[model samples]
Target: MEAILRIYTHYFIYYDIEMTQYANEIKISADNPKIGHVHKPNSEATLMGVNVNINSDGLRDKEYPVERGQKYRIIFLGDSITFGWGVEKEDTFETLLEVKLNEIKPTEVLNFGTGNYNSEQEVNLFFKKGQKYKPAHIVLFYFINDAEITPQKSKWEFLSHSRVITFFWSRIQGLMANLSESKSFKSYYSGLYSDDQQGWINTKKALTQMAQYSRANQIRFDVILLPELHNLNDYPLKAEHAKIITFLNENNINGIDLVPFFSSVEDPQELWVAADDAHPNKKAHQMIADFSFDFITRGIKWEKN
Candidate 1:
């Protein structure tokens, strides 16, 4: 009875997700021609931390074609934002960028984004699952939460956004009755928060690895600093931005600060990022693509450039 109880309370109660369990981008459906090949839109159901965040990459096992004589393979690696979070797969920024980049550089673009995937998971994915394409440029998208907080145990173990467990954990942590009343389990719950810490650390490590990986694999790298719903003005823009820029600069890597451009607007609704989702909408993706093009060209004005 004790053994069964232990098993039930331990391993059976929680488990980390594996790469195999993920639903990869399968096909690009043209039915929604204007929107492109969005496999699944309006997916309300979430699995763990991922399902609630509906995104589709429109990928398959088969290799796709690149433009003739293209020397570089540019791969967009990140979470649902790269996967076009709330937008249809066709309207994803990567796809938009593909249309735009072709007009700029002699490179091919591949969109390899997914839901609930952190920076470490993304880097790991490129080496293992996405090796076939042999990427030359990896664009690491950013969210403010990437640096400040860690993924909860639910996020680490599950990979979805709608976890009430972590919320409860955060709320209950300060409560004497919760943590003190159940010392053993409370300690265990507290330890779970480290996963987010580890995730943030992994992000830095991944950034460094990106520079090395680019050289080792002959790829150029850029970090696109995205934002959460928060406004940058409320935060220490100069100091914090300096820290980030310094980090990337030390690595001799370029970073495009999307915060200034994104934060200029007043309407969070206008941003078109999914209302409850982590990714931006079609318009926002296009704006990002345009901004990326301008950054690559070393120009400020998208229209003038």
Candidate 2:
């Protein structure tokens, strides 16, 4: 009986509670022709058993005025991780960092994160909506997959109804794709930066545009490269990280890699939302907030010459 209980616990945590199980019911995304998509304004839903609320501005934070109003306004851009997927809004690094920074002075860190957002979409979103916030600083929480092309929602309606089928179908498709390309996960990730990949090309252009705009406007801008939390002890994506950092340096943008802070953990899975879902949990978000608080408060000068 004890052994059966253990097995059931394992299955529930590692398999039954996966993101694929709840992907169907989350209806926060709204189609936007200009920048691909954005979260539906004033939307609220339960995603992966966590409450997700979108403000009137379509951001994942509380609504704020367009004017800075003597507050040091900071805007963060990224995908789901930055959106605090599987985590609460208060537990998100952005919220934590905002609280920490406000201790020093008046500050507001606005979260402009969305799921499935690539660099192009993020930058475009900033120009379209985020600029009106009059942020004094901008931070892009860049994940490894940000260079990939924007993904369209799957049109398979049936898959949405059955979690079991959705899970199996995803696994099967992934296996087939890997087999057909003769590519492992490492190779597949590294291949995203190939010279011919339009996604990577567009990513570079988008980042460059952001850096240039930030400089011209005198807004301090930086990129915090969020690591893939799958494995931290022996990270296999160092090469990809270096490639991104080099690009940032060439474009005169500061890239802060957060891998070392996370890699120090003995077991990376402890920081995950679930055994199967690698999105950072509340603990990981706290660590990020602590580290970022120091960095942001230091007022490091990023010279663009």
Which candidate comes out best when scored by lDDT? 2
Instruction: Return the number of clashes found in candidate 2.
Output: 0
Q: What is the TM-score of each candidate against the true structure?
A: 0.60, 0.85
Tens digits of per-residue lDDT, candidate 2, 164-249, equal 55445767876887677645667778889887898899899999999999999999888888878877878989988999999999
TM-score for candidate 1:
0.60
- Candidate 1 Cα deviation (angstroms), residue 83: 0.6
* lDDT, candidate 2, at 117: 83
If candidate 2 were superposed on the true structure by all CA atoms, what would the RMSD be? 5.4
Regions more than 4 Å wrong, model 2? 1-34, 153-165, 174-183, 300-305
Error of 2 at 18 (Å): 7.1
